[model samples]
Target: MLDIRPIGRSMLNKVPEVTLVFWLIKIMSTTVGETGADYLAVHVGLGTSVTGLLMITLLAAVLAIQLRMDRYVPWVYWLTVVLVSIVGTQITDALTDKLEISLYVSTAAFAIALAATFAIWFSVERTLSIHSIVTQRRELFYWAAILFTFALGTAAGDLATEALGLGFNVGVVAFTALIAAIAAAYALGANAVLTFWLAYILTRPLGASFGDLLSQAREYGGLGFGTIYTSLAFLTVIVALVAWLSFEADAGGKPEASPGA
Candidate 1:
């Protein structure tokens, strides 16, 4: 009985705003990234390198699909995010566990990659706001930065837990505190772009730590529920949320312009 034409139009201009729902889902996805990667590498009997490679392949395919999309589809965009999160976690794990790379080096590499992506993105597109995703180059840079954030988050999380002996609980606390601080700055009228990006990067580690808390063994100071169960739970939530967002849109809907406008 309702008009249904607007849904397609809504997706063409920009992504959804940085709402609480967005942050909640983003954190959940990142948490799954940590646990899901570990499940494949450890429980599934695949070596870290193999698992990383497999995830990377899957990520590449998903990204290609995402790139070809003319506009944002809630399901398509979120699926890409979830896949990239898995791939990012694997990349950090491979570097640290398989190649014996130091966390510092991996973190630095990810930071550099993030910077380069931004540099190219801004140089080519002239704007990095999510509200202005009007071109392919901007989208490319967005995805690239997202990938690096997950990788950097993994490396930073591990470094805190392993190299510094901070433990998982502490790591979660630290990352959470940082995110809160960033949010406070944003509330105080700091640049939305800067605050949003800072919080975005930090959320990866915060979510990763929470995932470790939920899925790791009790001996390792976790609940030991295992990754499969955790991933399933999160995936269910993701599906439900995406479905709700899709159904709630007006006909010929347009995605709201993000606050970063």
Candidate 2:
């Protein structure tokens, strides 16, 4: 069994409480990740390589600030997440579009990488629960796992929707159904940690599909909203929610992290 110690959960925890709001931000961040990366690479003409470097540098700076903090600050934490989302998408895009690597190969490699991260994390800390990320080492492992999940999700999602010709609409429905099934399993007494990770991985692709559905041209089976409108709209909602969560935390209305079994 995985160890899930609840001892130092109060002020030491570095992550936010896993709740509906948390998932909402997560999904939308991923949507921004998908559309935002494309817009910068193609529309703004930075290309994936250059945009990746800038985003990676920005992510490193934000992560440094995040690490220096002792407790979870809503803006700082979510900013780190948003950066991670963009960087992750860039990483996968570089491999697929520039290097001409197959999505299947990239997807498999990221899966193995994520598994290895968890294996080492569990070995060193004896716990894989987000609730136990009260130390710098644990937080490092968590972030590594997160990066891989997003990269892997990008590859897998691209394989399904584009390579396999599922199109954006069907991809959205398929991934959403899969997430619903995972939720049902969790409700039926599945291990919380396992289900949490599963749902987390699935949401990346679900959000990507949804992003494409909104941002792509109508001829390509989308709503023709364009990347600018889609990204700006989602980012607006994300900002409002983060501010609200920050206020709630100030009011001592914090939510608890999810259970880890």
Q: How many clashing residue pairs appear in each of the predictions shown?
A: 8, 0
- The global C-alpha lDDT for each of the candidates, from Candidate 1 onward, is 0.82, 0.90
Candidate 1 overall lDDT versus native: 0.82
Q: Top lDDT: which candidate number?
A: 2
Instruction: List model 1 lDDT by residue over 1-261, tens digit each.
Output: 322232223235436668888898899999988888888888898978888888888887777777666666777788889889999998888888778999999999998989888788788777777777655656767888899989998898888877898888998899999999988988889988878888888999899989988888899988888889988888899889888776765456646665663
Could you estimate the TM-score for every candidate?
Answer: 0.91, 0.94
145-238 per-residue lDDT for model 2 (tens digits): 9999899888999999999999999999999999999999989999888888888888999999999999999999999999999999999999
The most accurate candidate by TM-score is 2
Which TM-score value belongs to model 1?
0.91
